[model samples]
Target: MAMPTIKAVRAYTVRGGGADYHDTQGYHWIDDHIATPMARYEEYRQSRRSFGINVLGTLVIEVEASDGTVGLGVTTAGEIGAFIVEKHLSRFLIGRQVTEIEKIWDQMYFATQFYGRKGVVVNTISGVDIALWDLLGKLRGEPVHALLGGPVRDELQFYATGARPDLAKEMGFIGGKLPLLHGPAEGDEGLKKNIEKLADMRSKVGDDFWLMYDCWMSLDLNYSIKLAQKAQEFGLKWIEECLSPDDYWGYADLKRNVPKGMLVTTGEHEATRWGFRMLLEMDCCDIIQPDVNWCGGITELIKISALADAHGKLMVPHGSGVYSYHFVITRHNSPFTEIIMSAPNADEVRPAFSPLLLDEPVPVNGRMKASALDKPGFGVRLNPEVKLHRPYAAA
Candidate 1:
């Protein structure tokens, strides 16, 4: 059989689930008087329904091959990704072979360098790159992990990222990472409350279950150290993204300052190998968390992972649905995966990218068996119920 060539690339901005989408922006709590990290938590505790999860939406990418096999991918890019895909990226991919992923990725990167080295441009590239991977997988009749060199493990252990570690523990997740609500501007009281929140969670989940904080690029070096120091008393597993992704020196300093046992991790916002090279070479973090969707997709993630492995750093991708799962199961260094608790109160273990993906695999008893993802490509489809807004259609 002849290899299938890429026929067209399509981008869609889709409105996913209503309440359960978990928009990160909606969680930001800024109060002048309250002035504490726990303010958001307290607010959430009091009025869960009032803080409605408004849809920030998603960008879905579809790559069609000559044989009519369509492979799907998605990201948080929204209309921006759709524009890039339909206007700029579609031209490079339309007549190329589906197997030319690396070359295509390079072309996309260099072509967009004037206007796009990071941020939404990389995100747009990521969606297209993932679609290309999916396209190739379908054309070859293999799952993505198998194409990446087969699974090194039989099952993938999971940690949850959400508001409720207690609920996550009950659901069989190994650990739960809570988002840090207050930034440096909140002052010393906020720092105390941040530690207090972790302490409260520790009391509920117990010391045996792993507990971590996702600072979400909201803290300064001094605040992070104080929080980490206090967190040590509660046996906190790690402190993630305490500073901006660009602060390599700060990360190095924070890594050295934290308690001996705890780990320092970052890079959920950083992109590509060059971005990660700074993290590894600076010896800034113990673990690197690259989102496969945001960090240039599977092709770039492989490169990023290899660099982390070379440096003896763990490559735990940020929770990005099935896209991360396939890559996690295949790599020895990844060790485990992350699942974002999509339940309203973070009380239930729903599929990570719920209502957006039709057939996403959820972890069973804190683990996803390899069999769940054995289907060709990424093993999921875009939910047809979503209202897709195609910004630009090719001729």
Candidate 2:
């Protein structure tokens, strides 16, 4: 069989202004949003786990071939470096072997040296590269896991990273956690309310549940320490991002204040192996959470997992879990995986690998288990029936 050659790649964006923020997770604390699916890009809210998960602009990359197969990749629009995929990336991919997804990733990463390395630009490269991997795998007849190594476990173990007041014990999650709050957590009375709320959730769910709290770059170290000390009573699995990502000293302090068992997890916002290396080298974090979207996709995710393995550490991928499911399924050593308990991102649910034809089969228990699309490439789906909410011209 001849390798499918890329013929064309097009980018599209969607924005919906002042739409109801129906992310549900955001409404856990504040009941302000309107809950309307956006038709086009909205500027304020992009896809993020913490802070505000408002829908802003969605970026879609469609790669077409002469054989009629097309692969689709998505990231939030309006990101600083996403343009590389939208503008310059297609030139290199127009007539190359889609199966050479790994080589394509390296080329894209190094090709953008002139544009200053790291952050959004490199991340966008990874997003497109992952979609292409899914495309390439489908072109053949193997799963993406077969390409990486092989499946470590049939079903991935996950924790409900987002918690709700009502479904404390009803939800059959291995672990559960309270939502993170921002810095301006009011005065002492407000802090008291936050603590009481967490305490109530714990009381409702009882022990034997691994609880997590996301700081989401909200609270300062001092406040985080106070909460961490108080939070020890509830038996949390980890207190995430108590300090800033850069504040190694704060992490060290928070780690010291909390019980030995309470983990200090961060790096969800951090990017790449080098960025994760900092978290590893300092011994600042007991657990590392790198978002697959922001991180350099599977190529770097495997490398980062290896780093964690060498350090005798644990790696749990962060947001927009397209790449995360693949990583968690293939790697045996990775400890715990996560699912956005609120609502999985729409883009996350979108099929990125259409040309190959696949599905990101979700777990029967509301988590993503393993890829059934054990074809030759990344087992992802690209739906031709997609109606672009905001096309480039339409925007």
Candidate 3:
């Protein structure tokens, strides 16, 4: 039995998932002068044929081992990730043993430090890091959770993130997290509408099932606190990413100001342990939600979770398909998991990354049995029918 050496690293830019595939109905990323909520902007943009939702466009990375095992990973980096993997990061991985993940991660991070400690660059590193984990899991003939010290719990309970908490309740999810449709620029009426929407959802879902808001990094300190204070009457469980991920002081202020018993959570957009340290040390948030794809992959997540646990905070990773599920089950601190309800109205349960992932796991009655993920590696493969565009190839 010999160790498998990485032979090549390839990046695939994949497209096509029909009209409903993109998660574009949330926040708008453009500058404030032109920025508007996605819903309002999308209609006009569509009419002009000048823009379309490209959020679903994915950059998938495949790391091939000398023994013919190919491990798969994906991210939101689009073509930029493809370029990083094919041209830069691949050099660090091409001949290394798959088991040297930490060393490889360090080299990749430091090598790219001058240009990338976060954002698309970290996203690029994430895709590669995940592929390496998938590779190692396959070589060892074990599921990723087993490699991460096995499950601490027998099953994973889930909450849904979508438009309809009522539908999520019917599907047996423990809670439903809705997107805040407006931001600070929307004014006082917008704040009223935000609370009104939560109140309406609270009336529908009733008092027992938890309801929370995914503010999506779109609120200011004053607006978030106002929204949180109003939302408390409706039993909001937490205000998530209400302020920018970088606003540690604002987060700390919000945490202190929010009505007691309502938690403040963030970090879905934050990257690396150093970034998360600011959140934890400042007592900025009660819970930390790191997206594995964007938060430096599972390697960094392990470190982040340990830090959260040390601080007595919950490490509920923002949903990223089975990648997060595998990590969630292995840790005690991650009490539950999140499922991105794919049904247009959040009425039906479907794999979050449907069409993109073959053999993807879905929760049964808001719970995922541990046995469901028993397959080797991440237990998933790229949907063969989907076209993968390899813009760059290693030499």
- In TM-score terms, which candidate is top? 3
Q: Quote the RMSD, in angstroms, for model 2.
A: 6.1
| Deviation from native of the Cα of residue 86 in model 2, angstroms | 3.0
Which pairs clash inside model 3?
none
- In candidate 1, what are the lDDT values of residues 136-181, reduced to their tens digit? 8878889999999999998999999888888889989999998775
**Tens-digit lDDT string for candidate 3 (66-165):** 9999998888788777888898998899889889899999999999999999988998888888999898999999999999999999999999988888
lDDT for model 3: 0.84
lDDT of 2: 0.61
Q: Model 3 misses residue 97 by how many Å?
A: 0.9
RMSD of 3: 3.7
True-vs-predicted CA distance for residue 288, candidate 3, Å: 0.2
> Model 2, 2-26: lDDT tens per residue?
8878877766543321111222343
Q: By TM-score, how accurate is candidate 2?
A: 0.80
